[model samples]
Target: MKNDFEEKMADIMIGEAVTALLDEGVAIGWAVLTERLRLAIENETDENRVRAGLRAIEEVRREMHTRASERTGLPRVEDRSAHKLH
Candidate 1:
């Protein structure tokens, strides 16, 4: 059986996917929310909200890393070129 941490991480990964799905023109009836997410990425004027969104995104990414480690039994490659000869 998967460890609790691994299971939580997998759930977070799925949540992140759902968030991304909603981000791509899902029309959640709140443009501000989406704009905030965009502004978070683009570093908009609202630093506090931007920071919050960034934190949320970062948390999801961390969870994804954990889940990937569990599912793939590997870490993500920072440089795929290392796998190939240039």
Candidate 2:
């Protein structure tokens, strides 16, 4: 029962909403990862354990960057803090 313009508008609105939700989810995920890395660094006493934790954190970060780049069709930016929502 909808006209072509109305259908197109609905699609556009849906796309925007989906993009917003994805962005928020990514922000929350990054915040959680950052907190975990901070805690690991702060509480760990052993150098090896701290190094391992840092490696794990870095791996997760790289994976997230790759996924985001693939999704957006844009190259990954070096300054992740600039993209932080907080």
lDDT leader: 2
TM-score of 2: 0.49
What total of clashing residue pairs does each candidate reach?
A: 0, 0
TM-score of each: 0.39, 0.49
Model 2: how large is the Cα RMSD against the reference?
18.8
What's the TM for model 1? 0.39
Best by TM-score: 2
lDDT string, candidate 2, 1-86, tens digits? 33454444434433443455567775446556645555656787876555555555665667788888989987676665677798
Q: RMSD for all candidates, in order, please.
A: 10.3, 18.8
Worst 10 residues of 1 by lDDT: 27-36
